[model samples]
Structures are given as structure tokens and as C-alpha cells.
Target: MAEALLTLAGVHTHIGQYHILQGVDLEVREGELTALLGRNGAGKTTTLRTIMGLWKASQGRLRFEGRDIAALATPEIARAGVAYVPESMAVFSDLTVRENLVLGARQGRLDSARLEWILGFLPALGKFWNHQAGNLSGGQKQMLAIARAIVEPRRLLLVDEPTKGLAPAIVQSLLAAFRELKATGTTILLVEQNVSFVKRLGDRVAVMDDGRIVHAGPMPDFAADRALQMRLLGLAMEAHT
Candidate 1:
């Protein structure tokens, strides 16, 4: 088995008055995609936020490359070779696509080769290279968000529902981009409800319910077992696009 690039052990999170995560544990192996699957309010987004230090983990540990990051700030986490793409597609609405990519490059400059590499798979970004992100369509903005995350090399990428509300055609484009990233050995922890997207891309799977992982293992095994899907997700994997 490949070594883990990121791990969360007994992680818990609280939001002012409520506990959002309770004893959550997850592992994202180097050079593979791990699908974090669950129904709404299962703390999938909270798990990503906790890992990125967007939300403090009230308990437990988060480690990246064997270093504790539960206490690290969000910018420090990014500096540590981790990038996050929220489900909201939080692009800089006021900035041009070029400026957004420049900001994403932590070293203060974009690598021409890497930019070309990203564009190779995500051509839409190149098409709207100078357009303000706010003016782009939903799918285009999603592409820009992903492009920004990969503008520089990263040890791990935490993405939330990249395909949500996207047209099937756009989803296919994202599927291709992720495939290229996988080929480059990028480790990814993806939180997604679109089982069809992950079914083709995920190497491992973890299902969360009630803020805890209730089932986890190889993606093929989980996807093949319809009963397991129904029991854990309360819906069929085939039911999602």
C-alpha cells in the first residue's frame, strides 16, 4: 500500500454552540484519490475545513507529511503544500483569471510550464484567461477554482463537491482534469456526493454519517456492493450523476 500523505485521527470540531465533528478519522494516501462520501450534514465539508485549519479541530489530530497541522493557520496549511477548493467555487470575483492564478502561486510567480500543463486538461481556463472570474459561468468559475489550486505543486488537494450543480458535460471535463492530476501523482481527498464522478476516479472510499466515518475501504469494493451503499448513504450510488 502507498504511504499516507494526510491523516486525521479522532478529529472533532465545534461551531460556537454545537459539535459538528465527533471523533472523525480519515486517511488520504499519497498519489491516490480518496472519496469522502456521505449525505448532507454528515460533516463532509467540516472535515475538509478542519483539515485545512479553516475550522479548528476541538479535539484529535491532523497530520500532513507526518507533521501535526491541527493548530496551523489556513495560510500556513497552504504553505505546507496543501490546497483547498471549497464547494462554493470561491474564485476572486474581482480579479481576472490571470491574476487569480498568480495569487494561487505561492512563490509569487506562475510557472509557465505548469500553467500550460494545467491548461492542457482545462482548456476553458485558457479561453477565459483575461476575463474577470465573476463574469464566467458557473462551470467556468469551477474550472478557474480548480486551476488556481493546481497553479503550483501541492502535496494534497482537498476539494468539496467539484461537480455539484454542473452540467454533465462540465462534469466530464472535471473528471478529465482530475485524471490528469492523478497521473501526475497528486494526492487528493475529495468530498463529493456525486458517486458517478468518484466511482470512476476514486481509489479508496470512506462513508460518513452523523459526523463519523461509518464505512471505508477500497472504492471498487464499496461501489460494487449496492447494499452497503444503501445502508451507509441511504441511497444508491447509481442514483447520483
Candidate 2:
């Protein structure tokens, strides 16, 4: 078994007056894709933000590579080799694709080899290299967003809902790119609502609810149990798949 690259122990977070995360306990294994699954209002996004240091954890421990990082700032967390691909798609709409990717290089200089590799998997990024990010289609923009995150090497990627609001074909394209990325053995913690998508890519699974991870196990077992899915996700498995 691969050792956990990232671990959260009783993590709690507050946004304004709302207690978003009651207690989030999760382990992201090194070199494997772990799917963070939950129903709406399950605090999935908050967990990702807390890990990225975008939201300070009111209490608990967040450890990456075996060091305490619960109190680190966002930049420090990022510098520690943790990259976040937010659900908002956070692309600089006015900037060219090249320019946006240039910003993703944490050291202020793009690695040519890494850039070429990302472009090869996400060819749309190469095609729209000089175009304004806002001019690209939704799928293209998503590819660009992911491309930006990988402009440099990262040990762990916290990606939130990359398949949201995308057409089926575009989602498939994104899936292909992700599969190629998975081949590189970058550890990924993904938050997704699409059941089929998760079943296809996730090696391990964690289900979150009310800001806490309620279930954790291998993806195959989780996918095979329809009753478990209906209980945790509140939807019949057969109806969706």
C-alpha cells in the first residue's frame, strides 16, 4: 500500500459565522487518485479550501508529507508543492492562454519540458495558446485551467469539480487528459458530483457529509454497493448510471 501523502485529522473550519467543516478526516495516498464525494452542501469545497490554506482551519491538524501545515498561509502551502484547481475555473479571462500558464510556474519561469508535456495531453491549450482565455469554450477553458496547475511539478493536486457544467464530449476529453495525467503518477484529491466520472478514475473513495468524511474505502467496492450510494448520496445508483 502507498503511504498517505496528505492527511487531515479532525479538521474544522469557519467562514464568517458559519461552521463549514465540523471535522474532516481524509488521507490522500501518494501517486493515486482519491475521489472526494458528497451530496450538495456537504462542505466538500470547504475541505479543499482549508487544505489549500484559503480558509484557515479553526481547529485540527493538516499534515502534508508528514509535516504540520495547518497554520501555513496559502502561498506557503502552495510553495510546499500543493496545487489547487478551484471549481470556479479561476482563469484570467482577459489574458492569453500562454500568459495564464506562465503565471502557473511558481518559480516565475516555465519549465519547457513540463509545458510541452501538458500541451501534448491537452492539445486545446496549444491550439488556443495566443487566444484570450475568455474566448475559449467551456471545455477548452477547463483544459487550460488544469494546464495552468501543471505548468510546474506539484506533489499533490486538490481539484474541485472539473467536470461540472461541461458537455459529455468535453467531459470525455477532460477525462482523457486526466487519464494521461494519472499516468505521470501525480497524487490527486478530486471533488466531483458525476458518479460515472469518479467510478472510472478514482482508485480510492471518501464520502463527505456535513463537513465530515463519512465513508472511506476502495472505489470498486463503493461502486458495487448500490445501497451505500443511495444512503450517502441520496440518489439511486441505477437511475444515474
TM-score of each: 0.98, 0.97
lDDT of 2: 0.92
For each candidate in turn, give its C-alpha RMSD to the true structure in angstroms.
Answer: 0.9, 1.1
Name the best candidate (by TM-score).
Answer: 1
lDDT of 1 by residue, 1-241 (tens): 9999998999999999989899998989999999999999999999999998999999998999999999999999999999999999999999999999999987899999999999999998899999999999999999999999999999999999999999999999999999999999999999998998999999999999989999879999998899999999888778874
Lowest summed lDDT window (length 10), candidate 1: 232-241
Best candidate per lDDT, number?
1
Tens-digit lDDT track of model 2 for 50-159: 99999999999999999999989999999999989999999999999999999998688888888888887788888888999999988888888899888888999989
Give the runs in model 2 whose Cα sits over 4 Å from its true position. Answer: none
For candidate 1, what is the TM-score?
0.98
Cα error, candidate 2, residue 170 (Å): 0.7
